[model samples]
Target: MPVAYNDDMDKRLIQLGAAVIDTEAHAIAALRTRINGNFAAACKYMLACEGRIVILGMGKSGHIGGKIAATLASTGTPAFFVHPGEASHGDLGMITEKDVVLALSNSGETEEICTILPLIKRLGVPLIALTGQPRSTLGKVADIHIDISVEKEACPLGLAPTASSTATLAMGDALAIALLESRGFTAEDFARSHPGGRLGRRLLLRISDIMHKGEEIPAIPENVLLSSALLEMTRKGLGMTAVVNAQNHAVGIFTDGDLRRALDQGIDVHITPIAKIMTANCKTLGPDLLAAEALQIMQRHRINALLVVDTEQRLIGALNMHDLLRAGVL
Candidate 1:
């Protein structure tokens, strides 16, 4: 009977996983030495492309190609992935003469991909090949060839594509980032591409877009009693209220946190003027400012809310950091 040991096997499995990571790191490091004029030529071809980039590969290479296509598409290069096997079916109709085809193959002899080479040539689409064997058929026929060869696979059997796939993926990332930099892709541009992500919220959200305006803004006259201001704070649900002068300009702000401090000091809520207990140095934001900028001001000042003011110091809106969180700008 096999005995079950008390020691956990999880640590050994973690170390095995680390080995694959270490192997891929070394493989990418070695690729630095192989960067020659070919890499530059590949970038130049992509930069000069008038249409979208169509990526093609087979097996594990196909999986990496799909991710590369996504990265390229998000980074300002219009790109899409086409499985070589599917291209041999009806997918070949998606390609056009203006597009550039980026093909990936470890041995540079994937039959499915090679079968479509003649058709691609007939369409006059330029080909960029990524392969381990430069002398293989795919490389010889390609308009531009990029060498992505690796010394060995991280897999113990030396058959599974481990380091090679990692290297290919890294090359694809390098290409996308290089194009992004060359095209001056800004954070705002990136936000446009990822409207559902946190980065988009940070870059694209504006104060006017998330602030409480008109009656939603809590405000009380400077002569109002503290008890009345507290009711305004409670009704507005912002935990605070602005004290405005007869001219409707914000003079100070009072919050629930302030009320607690006032009570601790034995102040009378009914007789005390709201302006007397209000914060005179309250921070404010502009309606046109980015929501991310508003968050920074609130965090730096250790405050939870801010009043929106115009150039004339008139309060137009009010918002708390919670508003930013609710708007997905946090």
Candidate 2:
């Protein structure tokens, strides 16, 4: 049976949704005060750690910890999440004296985490705690404690880990970004960690890696007729052809747009030289240029293709927007 819609109920539902977001936003904003000396101290320990930062949490906190660990690992800091419950059952062996342990618990008295506190302390590893209660067992024993308390949860019943989880995740991001800045982590470094992602394609792919080279490039002499250039463009299927001199140096580019303008001007394709119809001093990129930089040039110039040249302006390669799309760099 379909339920009937009530106008008052609809308004109440939207109001409740807005309230939840408002509460969570406030929760996250409140965490800025927690980024004081204690936050810096935690970062210092994690930065000095020779080994990975091992994260431990329970339930919802565990989920946040996993994401935090991933952010740290991708931003030049080596880290991984270890479930506290599993740690007591032998996963604790994953931690070593060289590593730093980061524990998250809203109340800071999680039994599973508390169960292994002695073990972590015995290893002489630095223990950093993120908890709401500074007096809790885990907080008291931590080498550094950064509070992640929220005034209240978004849940009206106040039973769910709503605002608290948001606060914890925001704090985790602050730590990861701070360490990333301190380590001078670059986009290239991040790309190395995410080679299969879009950012990796944009950052790591050079024009040489994706451009059509050698015989695959469409090229002709400057004296060639527009008919010959058009055939070369058709054969190469790049919608464009480079016109070079006797020295194979690119002097101009003849694209579909040039062809349209030539036809509009009643120029005979068979008799007109490509040089007369081609765009002179066309935009070009070097083989060593990044694909992303090439994209910016193409977009800025409102062009669809680019010629790849060497230091001597000799045509070595060619690429179009299609190539960037295929290479996942667009």
Candidate 3:
């Protein structure tokens, strides 16, 4: 036997979920009004810090603090999360006088966090508190206080932390982005921090890094017959080949797909010159451009490959979409 919900109950649950979302959204939006001198002070303290920003929190705040630490660490700031409970045991040694501690507690009264505050104070470390209660002990004791107060919890019973947590997380993001902007963080700098991510591949990988060079490049002389060009395409295994003149300057390109189209028109591959059936205005890229830019060109034209050439229009390398795929840039 199983219990089933009526349509009325189902509608009520959906409405409840929607209300929760709307409430959280409103709370997060309200944070814009609270950004003032205190926020600026927090940023100044962090920017001046010679060591890491040590984040400490408990329960749900701990989870949000962890994410904030990661965001800060990846975006120019060196930060790490330390559990307040663990700090009392041995983690407090990780913090130094040069470091700044950011403590998060909705009530500004987490016993575990407060217990370690005196020890942190003795070491002359600056404290930044994010809490709903500005009048509480933690807020009063910290060097800087960020008010994250919310109108109400989204929970029906007002017990679960919903809107408050969302507001705090939004505040954390605000801090990270503000610091990121002040530091003049560039896409290349971000790529260095996230080398395993797609953005890293887009920013750090160049066309020459992934293009086929030497024998791997498919190329043939302009005087070669269309049949020999087809053989070169087959031997190199790229779908296309660069048609070079006697001076080794690329003049045109021939592809297997183009050969199919020529065959459909009853053209003879054995007798015709390769240039006769080649595409004259083939798309090409410079060896110094980013691989991502090359991918954009190939995708925009709906093509599969491109020839890498120098300013003199001499073929130096070649690449297909598959090359980008293998290099993890696609």
Which candidate tops lDDT? 2
For all predicted structures, in order, the TM-scores are 0.93, 0.95, 0.92
Candidate 3 has an lDDT of 0.93
| Better candidate number, 1 or 2, judged by lDDT | 2
User: lDDT per prediction?
Assistant: 0.91, 0.95, 0.93
- Colliding pairs, model 1: none
Candidate 1 TM-score to native = 0.93
Sorted on TM-score, best first, the list reads 2, 1, 3
Cand. 3 TM to true fold: 0.92
* Model 3 regions lying over 4 Å from their true place: 1-6, 310-313
By lDDT, rank the candidates, best first: 2, 3, 1
lDDT of candidate 2 over 8-48, digit per residue (tens): 98879888999999999999989877889999999999999
Tens digits of per-residue lDDT for model 1, 1-330: 956545559667777889988988998998886677887788888888888999999999999999999999999999999988989899999998779999999899999999999999899888999999999999999998988998889998999999999999988998899889999989899999998899999998899999999999999999989999989988999999998888888899998789899999999989998878899868887899999999999889788999999988899999997899999987
Task: Tell me the lDDT of model 3 at 34.
Answer: 82
Candidate 2 displacement at residue 220 in angstroms: 1.1
Alpha-carbon RMSD to native, per candidate: 3.3, 2.7, 3.2
